[model samples]
Target: MRRFYAILVAAGLVYMLFMFLGTIVPYGKADVADRVSAHFLAKDVNSISPTKWVEGDKQVPHSERVYGRKGFEDGSANVVTSIVVNYRSFDTLGEVTVLFASAVGVGLILGGTRRMKYGRKPNFILRVSTGILLPLIILFGIYIFVHGHLTPGGGFPGGTIIAAAVLLLYLSNEEFSLNMIVSKSLEGSMGSLYVIFGLIGLAAGGAFLFNFLPNGVVGSLFSAGVVPLVYMTIGLKVGSELSGVVAEIHEEREG
Candidate 1:
C-alpha cells in the first residue's frame, strides 16, 4: 500500500515536471536548434540576445537593462547581486529576519547545559589545524559577503561558511564557548542598520530601499553603495545567529 502511494506521488511529480517543461519549451525543435547554432556561431554574444515572447501592458518587451547600464543605476556588474540586494532588498530583509527568528526559536527550545562525556580528546593535529584554518576561513567568509555585489556568492552562503568555521572550533575544543550577549547584540545592530537604511531611503523622498548612495565606479571594490554594507550586515547577523544556534544545540546535546 505504501509502495503504491509512493509510486503515485512519483508519477504525479514527474507529470508536473513534464508539464512545466512543455510550457517553457515549445513543441518545435527546429527553432530551438537554429537559435542554439546561431548562439554558438555569433560574433558578438551581446548581439545574440535571448528573445522574450512575453510582452507587458504596453505591448513592449522588457530588455536587459542591467547589462546595458551596469554602472548608471547600481554599480553591480553581477545582475543577481543587484537584483537581490538593491532591487528586492526589502524581501531580503524579510528573509534574514525569518532566518534569525527561526534560529532564536530553536536556540530557545534547545537552551540548556547537559554535557555528554566522550572519552577521546581531539588529537593535536586536528586542534592545531583548526586553529590555523579558523581565521583564514573567517576572512574568506568576509570576502564573499563583502564582494557579493561583484561576485556570485552573497551574505547567506558566506554567513553559513563562517558558522561552519565556528562549528569546527566547537567540535575541536569542548571548552570553546560562544558569547550569547555579544552575538545577540551584533545581530540586533545589523538588523537595525538594515531598517535604518530603508528609512533613510524613505526620508530622501524616494520609496523604501531606494539606491540613495552614490553609484561609484563599476566593478570596483567600493562601487555598489549600500549593497556591500547590507550584505556584510546580513553576513554578521546570520553568522552570529547560526553560531549561537549551534552553541545552543551543542550545549543541549552535551550539557
Candidate 2:
C-alpha cells in the first residue's frame, strides 16, 4: 500500500510538471499600449467619455467639482487619501478586524496562557539601554503616524512603536506579563468602533465613511476629516495585535 501511494504521488508530480510546462510553452507577448489605444478608440468610446451625463453648455467641473473641492471638503489634499479614509473607511475597519482576529488565532495556537519558566531579568546595562531607547522608539513611531498625511509614515509605523515598547518591558522585567485580556479587549473594541463609525456615516448620510466634518485648510495639520481618525484606529489595532503576538512568542519561549 505504501509503495502504491508513493507511485501515485510520483505520477501526480509528473502530471503537474507537464501542465506547468504547457502554460509556459505557448508564451506570447502582446502590445499592451496598442491594445489600450484600440479600446479607447473603439466604436463604444461614448461609454468612456466623462461629459455624457452633463447637459447643455454647462462647464463640467472636472478638476474643481470632482476632486479638488470634493477632496478638500473632505479634509484631505491627496485625492487617494480622501477616497480611502472617507469613501472607503469601512474597508480599512474590516482590515484591522482581520488583523485582530489573526493575532488572537496565533495566541491560541501558541498557548498564550502558558507562563514563562525564566523571568526576564535584564542586567543593569541592558535595562539602562532599553530605558533610553524606549522613549526614542516611541517618539519615532508617533512622528510616523502623525505625519502620515504629509509624508510616508502612518498608523502602522506608530503601532509598531507601541508594540516595541511593550517588548522592551517584557525583556527588561522577568515578571512583566502583558495583559492579554486588556489588549484583546482594546483591539476588539477599537475594531468594532471603527466599523460603527463608518456605519454612522452611512446612516446620517448616504455613503459609508463619508466626511461630514468641515474640510479645513488643505495643507494644515487638521485638514483631513477622517484620515486622522481612521489612522488612529489602525495604529491602536496594530499595536495591540503586535503586542499580543510578542506576548505569545515570549510565553512559548519560556515554556
Candidate 3:
C-alpha cells in the first residue's frame, strides 16, 4: 500500500514537470536556442513573450535584453542574480534555513561557553599583521554581498569571508571570545528581517519575496530592489551563525 501511494505521488510530480516544460517551448517542437536560458537572458522571466510559430523553427525567440534596460521583470544586470533573488527566491530562503539548522545542530553538540585551548601563544608579527588585515577582509566580504545583484559574489561567500575574519581572531588571540548574547541577537534579527521583507512583498505584490522596491538603473548600487537587501540580511545572519558555530567547536569542553 505504501509503495502504491509513493508511485502515485511520483507520477503526479512527473506530470507536473512535463506540463511546466511544455509551456517553455512547444509540444513536439524543440528549439535549442529558445530554451530557458533565452528567457533569462531576455529578462522575460516573469511572463512569457509573444510566440510566433514558423514552419521550420519552433518559435520566434525573444531577443536577448540590451544592457541597462529599465522596467523589466527584474532590474539586475546579472542574469544569475535576477533568477536567484527574483524568479526563485524561495529556494534561497531554504538555503538560509538549512544553514541555520546546521548552526543549531553544531551548537547542540558542542554546547558551552568555554574558552579555546591553543597549543602556543601567537607571535607579535602574526598578531599585528592580522590587526591590519582583518578590517580589509571583513570590508571585502561586505562588498561582495552588497554588490551581489551586479557582481559574481553573493551572501554565502561574503558571509563566509566575514566568518573567516572571526576565525582569524581566535587564531591570533588565545583569549579572544565572542559574546554569545550579542551574536545571537544579531543573528536572530537578520533572519527575522529576511522573512519580514518577504512577507511585506507578499502583502504588496501578492508574491512572496517579490521585488517590492522601486527599480533603479541596472548594474547600479541601489538596483535589483530587494535582492541587495536580502543578500545583506543573509550575509549578516550567516556570518553571525557561522561565527557562533565556529566558536562553539573551538571551545575547550568542560569535562
Candidate 4:
C-alpha cells in the first residue's frame, strides 16, 4: 500500500512536469520586444492619437471614447484615471463589489472562531504622533481622489492611503475594535449607489456610464461630469474593504 501511494505521487509529479515542459517547447525563435514594438506601431495612430481623442473625437472607436480618452477630454491628463472613473466606471464599481466580497470572506473564515486582541498599548509619544498624522493622511487621500480627473492620482492610490490610516489607528489604539458592521455596511451601500447611478445614466442617456451631467469646460474642476463622483465611491469602497481585511488578519493572528 505504501509503495502504491508513492508510485501514484511520482506519476502525478511526472505528469505535471510534462505539462509544464509542453508549454515552453512550442516557442519560436522570435524577439519578444520586437513583436511588442511591431504590434504597438501597427495600431491606428489617428484613432488613438492623444490629441485627437482627448480634445474631441473626430473619428475614434466608441470603446476608446467611453473608456480610453476621458483623461485628455476632461483635462485629467491620465488615461488610466479617465478609464477607471469615467469611461469604464461601471467596471470599477464591480471591482469594488469584489473587494467587499473578499473582505466578507476573510472575515467569515478568520473572524468566526474567536476574537482576541494583541499588541501593546501605544505610549503617549506614539499616540500624539498618530493623532497629528492621521488627519493629514486623510486629507491627502481626499485630494488624490478629487483631482483624479486633472492629475496623476486616483481612487485606488487614495483608498490605499486611507486604509493605511485605519491600520495605524488599529495599531496605536489597542482597546478600540474596528466596527465591522459599520465598515461593511458603508461599503455595500456606497457600492450599490454607484451601480444604481450608472444604471440611471443608462436609462436616461441610452448608454451605460454615459456622462449625463454636462461635460463642462475641459480641464476644469467640475468638467468630467460623473468622473469625480464615481472616484469618490470607489475610494470609499476600497478603503473599507482594505481596512476590513487588515482587521480580519489581526483577529486571526490574535486567535
Q: What is the TM-score of each predicted model, taking all chains together?
A: 0.71, 0.66, 0.76, 0.67
Off by over 4 Å in 1: 1-73, 113-119, 253-255
Give the Å error, residue 116, model 2.
Answer: 2.0
Q: Pick the candidate with the highest TM-score.
A: 3
lDDT (C-alpha, whole model) for all candidates: 0.72, 0.64, 0.77, 0.67
Error of 4 at 165 (Å): 0.4
Off by over 4 Å in 2: 1-74, 78-80, 117-123, 252-255
Q: Put down candidate 2 lDDT per residue, 46-128, tens digits, no spaces.
A: 12345422214654433333334433233554444554565556576666767777887887788545557554357878678
Candidate 2 vs candidate 4, lDDT winner: 4
> How well is each residue in 1-255 modelled by candidate 3, as lDDT tens digits?
978855754664465456446556466778776554555654543234664323244444333233333443457767787778777788988989999998999998987868967788788898999999999999999999998888898888999999999999988998899889988999988987887787677657756676889777666898877888998999999999999988997886667
lDDT of 2 at 63: 38
* Candidate 3 structure lDDT: 0.77
Cα RMSDs, all models: 13.1, 14.0, 9.1, 13.2
Candidate order, lDDT descending = 3, 1, 4, 2
Candidate 4, residue 124: the lDDT equals 77
Name the lDDT value of residue 160 in candidate 2.
89
Model 4 ranges with Cα > 4 A deviation: 1-75, 112-115, 252-255
Q: How many Å off is the CA of 53 in candidate 1?
A: 16
Clashing pairs in 4: 66-87, 76-149
Q: Is candidate 1 or candidate 4 better by lDDT?
A: 1
lDDT (Cα, 0-100) at 114 in candidate 1: 62
Estimate, for each residue in 1-255, the C-alpha lDDT of model 4 and write its tens digit.
Answer: 978855754664465456446545355765664442332232332344453222233555534543444322343445566666665665776777677777778877877433346655577787789999999999998889888877888888888898899888877777656888898887777776676566656556655565677665445788677787877877887887788887777675432
